[model samples]
Target: MKWTRAVHHLTDLVEKVSEMPGTHFRFEVVELWVFGDLLGAPRDLEHIDVALVVDLPVDEVPWLTEPLGAEHWANASRVSRNPVMPFWRSAQAPVWNHRIERPALAWSKADGIAEETLVAVGDGTGELVRLPAPEPDELRKRLDDELALSLAALRHDNQVYTDRRWSPGKLTPYADALWRTTTGYLDLLDALAR
Candidate 1:
């Protein structure tokens, strides 16, 4: 997917989250962080990873009173009542990974938030770590760096495939796919440079 398209999809998600009624989930998205492969702006992304810091009111889900385990503190620098789980599941209690029809976006229905997207619920206590918003220029530079690294890895693998005397039938398709991805990265870089 093109970087522009991915950005649009992310924007749609944020809009949807912002518009979600507190009554529905008994929580509000206080902070959002987009990371992983989506940050690289690759041509064909596997998925988008978003980390949401949410205010899950104490009155709601009163069972989540204490930290879950030691690992939670090690990773996030804060104790979590539950391990980072799919926000949708928490949103739709008793229905795990539920998909419901809502408004449509460029790539998915309004309810089709990526399954990989996770939420860290904060229960009134100020223990949950809140990260500062990422700067756009820094994120763009990081994307450029990641794209370059990906291109290098692809090129190296293509070279290895050639060295192994892979047949044209096999090599041609792989090379073509790589070329398309390389072109996509270049196109994104050009757009970002503008």
Candidate 2:
């Protein structure tokens, strides 16, 4: 449920991908975070996500533009962040609403990974081990344990959040989304590795 285990798992994912052949370059487990509400998630997802970047030959950037998701990478060209909103950033910040803000968890051009140090870790081992999928019941228990921390955040302003904010039914969509992506992604990565 802690960030460390999620980070370790990400490192494992990166290592697994790197072990595969024909990577444009390499995969880095560069960042992880749990966003929105993770109270009692099926997994202690740091809302966990990772970046896969290749050390494209400086000359080969052209080849990658179409293949490696150039649209998201375009955010890097402006490289800016705003302070008033720690979570909000933009090329020309300190301005208005609907600023074409960059995502807080986006990949950097240099690191090609998320830059949060909250849970970043790696080891220089020669080989890595595969981790079993996390136990869902156990993960939800941990998340439920952590929910006490969010009460303060939700109590601000005239509006107050309560237990009803999270019905078990509300989680089905999130779980389905996670399942669709993680399983599909793992399948794609496995095929690519093969």
Candidate 3:
């Protein structure tokens, strides 16, 4: 399963969640990233990162988390990629960002999102520690940079309009098959202010 299919999977969940009891707001997929951390070279062996935003009640946050976690873990080993973080949460407004990306995973891994599977065997950074909050704009910028290069290369080679960020250009080839095999991941963030 490629990123697109994974996205559809996410949307399926979202639709289900929205129909539940009370206060269900609109949501959007804001980010999608893939990278290979365990792989020494930036060639292969990576993870998929996904993020979505919705305006949901804070009290119900855990409702989404628990179910999503169950689904993610059930499919993690299949992802084959790194720590696939298919995140989704409530936000105030839309995040006008890049469509999809292959390199965003690089930044996400560096930021310690997928360190568990990102590193090679016996490389898990077990135990958690306190850290500063994240800066979405910066990560988004990095994604934009890689996305630009990936798009250019794709257009140059395919000589056609891809329209689909993940598909058009093979920006990240591994993305071509994520739903087939994976572990776990949550790249989504909620911007309450936005």
Clashes of each: 1, 3, 22
Instruction: Point out the higher-scoring one by TM-score: 1 or 3.
Output: 1
> Model 3, 49-132: lDDT tens per residue?
444333443222221132223244324323323345544333432222332222222112114233332232112221121122
lDDT of each: 0.38, 0.29, 0.31
CA lDDT for candidate 3: 0.31
Worst 10 residues of 2 by lDDT: 78-87
Candidate 2, residues 75-124, lDDT tens digits: the string is 23111111111111121211111111111332333354442422323221
- In Å, residue 99's CA in model 2 sits off its true spot by 12
Model 2 TM-score is 0.22
Rank by lDDT (best first): 1, 3, 2
RMSD over all Cα atoms, model 2: 19.6
Model 1 Cα displacement at 113 (Å)? Answer: 17
Q: What is the TM-score of each predicted model, taking all chains together?
A: 0.29, 0.22, 0.23
* lDDT per residue as tens, model 1, 41-145: 245554444444445432221111211221332233221321222221122222111011111111122344433332211111111222334466655664564
* Model 1 ranges off by over 4 Å: 57-194
Say which candidate scores most in lDDT.
1
